[model samples]
Target: MPKNIYFIALCLLCIWGCRESASKAGANKKDSINKVVQDAAHEIAGNFSDQRSLRFSANRLDSFFTRYDSLRTFQKDLTTFYTERNYAFAWYSDSGLTEQASHLYVRLENLPEEGLNLVLPYKHTLDSLINAANTQTLEQKSETELLLTSLYFFFAQRVWAGLEESATQKIDWLMPRKKLSYSALLDSVLKQGNTANVKEPVYRQYNLLKEYLKKYKAIPASSTTISLPGNKPIRPGDTSPEIVKLRKKLFLLGDLTNAGDTSSDTYDSTLLTAVKRFQRRHGLSEDGIAGAGLIRELNIPVPQLIEKIMVNMERNRWLPTDVRGRYLAVNIPEFVLHAYYDDSLLWNMNVVVGKDVNKTVIFAGSISQVVFSPYWNVPASILKKEILPGIQKNPNYLEKNHMEWNGPDVRQKPGPWNSLGQVKFLFPNSHSIYLHDTPSKSLFQESKRAFSHGCIRVANPKFLAQYILRDDAAWTTDRINKAMASGKEQYVAVKDPIPVYITYFTAWVDRQGDLNFREDIYKRDAQLSSLLMKR
Candidate 1:
């Protein structure tokens, strides 16, 4: 065996023996373990890696895997990781452990802040080494080197890469997975001394949710539930004993900025504003009413909310980091379409998503075509299940609907009463789903707008169209309206296709830094929560 490798083995054996003796010592166990770690760290003598030049042997690197067999899954990655550095020690220097080493250890210890509850391999050993404060010897430095590498991989995979691509596909997430180069990321971290670059592999939302996770975790448990008197809705200026409890709940939830006089029962303007903010966050009708719905949301335990934040964090992990620049995102659960430019949300409008029976798929594509006065080509499935049956029930069903036969298929003529309204945004996919204007604008008024067959129903399609065509000076707002009202189906090719993401984020942090939660309209939260638990 190589000298450093042999030395590491001997020191580990002595440390284990001393740990056993300490376990029997009871009162002095912690002291004995600390002393043993410090002693072993000083005993092994060899030239460790320096600040500018790393000097660990590749032969000893092979022995590292043989010793830490549990981390064998990372052998290929660790090999490539070292080969990229010409067999350099990543977490140490000639003087002592590098600054990045301590930072990594602190972050690893506080993994829960990243919405993870992972029990890392050899964590106790790493803990002892980090606590020793002086890892000068080659054996200690080399062991630290390999362990840090393994832990880095573990952290990167869970916190950044998230679940495997196949696993996300099984969960019906067809969005492109964020491709990461772990070796390159580590190089940046080591060279720049900016561990913040670790966040580059995932979407920005992941870090936002991570920040909220820490805040949510620190929230004290509420022993009492906020309930309305006789389940009656309380409007502004209404007075009731329940209002007192409501104020405190809202304060703790970050809705009410001030809980002035928690004993007061009057529903003042201060409380009214908070109620509306809370309602908006919960995807409710923001009428500033303290109803049973708002009370129920307030009563939800902090731990459950924490779990929700964590679940959405996992979903954020499954997203491609390239969704930035300029894009349109439709959050299914929130029933809203958000237009973003360069990571800044420009505007948003209400949208009706697919019902549970015909659930919309989670995916991404580029909007290449916008059809004005779109003909509602009745799908074959809809034809067989709905139109054909309607025709059988009534002979004049087709004529009444302004439908005519084209070959073997049926299509509604482009008109005001057409099922697809006057416009449709197309992003061709196998699911045949797209965003289109809806005649039933009343559906958008509902709190839960999941009435579509599978495609999205945009409440403000005209405005969306104008925004999309803003770059083309010839296609003005008046031109877009004229195109829609022409009653002739016109397909306009987009000059620069905009990326569109159909995502299902039931919980997210908004631009105002306030946390928002929406209903899991398709009941996907439970399924995702189960998967996260198993992970």
Candidate 2:
């Protein structure tokens, strides 16, 4: 019995020894994987600091473009970007690919949010490298590095550079295109390790529009469409089945802030306020009534709004990265002029732009002088079209309108009845467009105020005169008012010239952070949209 017990005990001891050995082997294997992961991470962190260890032959870049035909357009830029870094591998490290590669991948995936529908030629190859199971060492390192560089340029061009200068010129957008060195921008982004921290890449408005794009995109594609039952205007305190639809629609559009009782069909006070707000945003008369114009704006689909936002984003990309310390900005579609001092908006006012047949030119200039009680020297186009024909019809037309011939040209005497009103702000350009006041004050009361003959008509010209001369100690408020009411033409040079940008934006985010859309009265959006989509 003792011998039998010893035999069983010996077998039990052998089994325990084998189990211990197997457990140790499993532990060693896990430790090996952990070491690999740690080494890869350390190597990636070191790649940015160690330049010499991550370079490849320049010939590889030449070869990459040959294989990737779609990226061939970026060959010149990639060459310059790499030559500046001495053919260094920007995306790879000693052990594996870096974090920026992953970041760029994510950005490329979300290109639509940037309002870009670009296609990456070697995206599948990039996908394989990033999503590979083996995270220790990257294979096809040369191809991967070139692919990443090309993509970086792609993103910068699409987001920052926008369409070429020629494209904008074709569409009559003459504002100087924002210039940027992608190589330098990439260096800064790499140093920070986050693209979001870099605002210099594009105009400030681009970021704002990007936020709204994400918001609008998050809305369901199948949102409810509101339809009114009748053509009659829906006024306040009137109950109709369409009131519920209006409430829900307004709430979704961010016009109606409070979500109170959306189920109620009654057009209550809350609905009235929301309708007025909507009217103000769309540049319609704030009557607080649901009319044809209001309903048309409300029925605009979310997708169409998204497209409008995208178009403006492209336009924003064309703006310079910085505005001067003091500047004037006139948005044609908005029919508004904004004054800025040191990048802060000082004030804004309604203005009348050119009619559709006489569209205002989009360009930039400097406000070098302000002419108070200015003479209205008519342009040749106007003289041939209106003044001369009027004189032929009525021999006393020029004299009746308080005008007389100044040499070969006709001029209106400076007074309240003058076509230029009390003041005209001049910035010399070939287009001959300028900011002036109109005697027709009633035009300012209208919602759509595009009635000028190319020159912008300021609503509050006296205030503009005071603001322009505020810094000039020689010209006080009383002096400015006297000069404006003097009834004598006087040209006063601006103490300091302020830059002026005449822009066209059908959609933009206002100072209140609300997305605002205006009519494409000049019919400019369609042409720009078509160009963007074809790409």
Candidate 3:
């Protein structure tokens, strides 16, 4: 046998004996499993005289299968994975453990700091294993290598891929969760051949959130929550002690540049400017008034904001990486529709999303059609909940609303009052939700705009229509206006499919590189916050 291989066999034999002693010493359950692993390693070592034997020694790992039941849903996958790889040390070289192994171990240790819920075991031991003195001998080197690989899988599953699909569905997040191939990711890590480039492959937003996470974490935690005493908006000439408190709060939150001046209790021009900046960063009215809306945002503590940032970071992990093509994303909480072409924001406008009771689903679809002057085929739920009640109050509800029964289903005629307004962007989805124009434009002016039944209501339909049909040569400004003016329902098929995501993120970074937080209208943040608190 090769000298190092022989030495490894002797170490495994010792490990087997030590596990037996530990079992006798009442380390019962896990020590017995360790004994099985040690035995399998030794049993396979006899045939390890050549690389050929090592390459074909898959059967030896079967006895230790029960040892990994803690891996839960990943157990069977781990089995087939190890068997296919012939139980070889995945992150090791013949001489010693590879550098990528250490990189992975450190990342696992830092996972919690990156907003992960669970804490990885044996971080200190893993750090000790990389110490200079521990590597003096090759004893137990392969075992350490395998242990690190297993830990890497555990960390990647929890932190990068997020909780299972059912768990995410419970939180009402319907966006497709991203999946990662551990083997492929490790292969790329190994291919890099250096520690400098080793990183967890996640969505682009993950990196952006990390930068903001650092910024938020730098703010010191407040000792006590302070409330601004006001039932109304503070005007420019208003004088109160609350103005001084508001100034300090905005300064702490980075809305004010100077923290040195605290001499005045009046809402001066400088204070008004800072308040306006703060209001703009938030999705509130930027009218330079410290109203209840602005004050509520101001009083949110740094720690709560940090938790919000971390929770959104977890959501970022579930985002698709390839957002390069032309796409329209509607952030439900922010009430904004962003048009992006290859990661660059083409334009953005206000939008009204579903209310608390009728939440717009968080999912993706391909927008393949745009309908102009569309009829509103009211959903059955709406018909039962709204139309029936309205009919009970007034028999002329159908005539007043210009709705007629067509083959037992009620639909409104295409016109100014048609619930879908002048245009509707169709993206085939099971949820039956799409973006459409609405006659109620006043709702868009509200800071909190969750008024629709389910579909999104775009504030600027003409702007969106023009931007969407820009590529089609046949559709010109005059033609689009003429088509919209024809007072007829028209369906225009989009040449290229644009991916649209109806997302729910209460906290997100805007195009101006500013961190913005909105009201948790659907109350999803608490559910995610609970999930993230699970150790």
The candidate that achieves the highest TM-score relative to the unseen native structure: 2
Model 2 regions lying over 4 Å from their true place: 1-51, 133-139, 220-222, 258-260
TM-score of predicted structure 1:
0.87
Q: Which residue runs of candidate 1 sit more than 4 Å off their true CA positions?
A: 1-54, 133-136, 194-199, 322-324
lDDT for 411 (candidate 1): 99
Model 3 Cα lDDT, one tens digit per residue, 1-535:
7666776777777676676667667766666667777665643442243222323244434433344344444555555556655665556554455566777766776775676656566556666766642454533454455456667677767767877788888877888877688766655666565544967667777767777777777777872234556576778998888777777777777777787745578888888888888888788888997777777777787888888888888888887766687999999989999988887888889999998998889999988888988889989998898898998999999999999888878899888888899889998999999999998989988988999998999998877888888889999888877766666999999888788988888777766777788888998988999987873
Show pairs that collide, candidate 2.
none
Q: In candidate 2, residue 527 scores what lDDT?
A: 92
Candidate 1 residue lDDT tens string, 31-94: 8677866765643321332543656888876788898998888888989988766787777766
List clash counts for every candidate, in order: 0, 0, 0
Which scores better on TM-score, 1 or 3? 1
Candidate 3 segments whose C-alpha is farther than 4 A from its true place = 1-97, 131-137, 194-196, 229-232, 237-240, 262-266
Q: Tell me the tens digit of each residue's lDDT in model 2 across 1-535.
A: 6553555566556556656565677987656655755564444454334543677787887677878888888898888978877888777655566666677788888888888777765777888866762453433777777887888888988888899999899999998888888888887777656666566567788888889898888766666666666768888888888889899888888888878757889998888888988887888889898988899999888888888899999998988877768899999999999998766899999999999989999999999899999999989999999999999999999989999999999999999899999999999999999999899999988889999889999999989888888789998888888998899999999989888999999887778888888999998989999999887
Which pairs in model 3 have colliding backbones? none
Q: Which lDDT value does model 3 have at 179?
A: 69
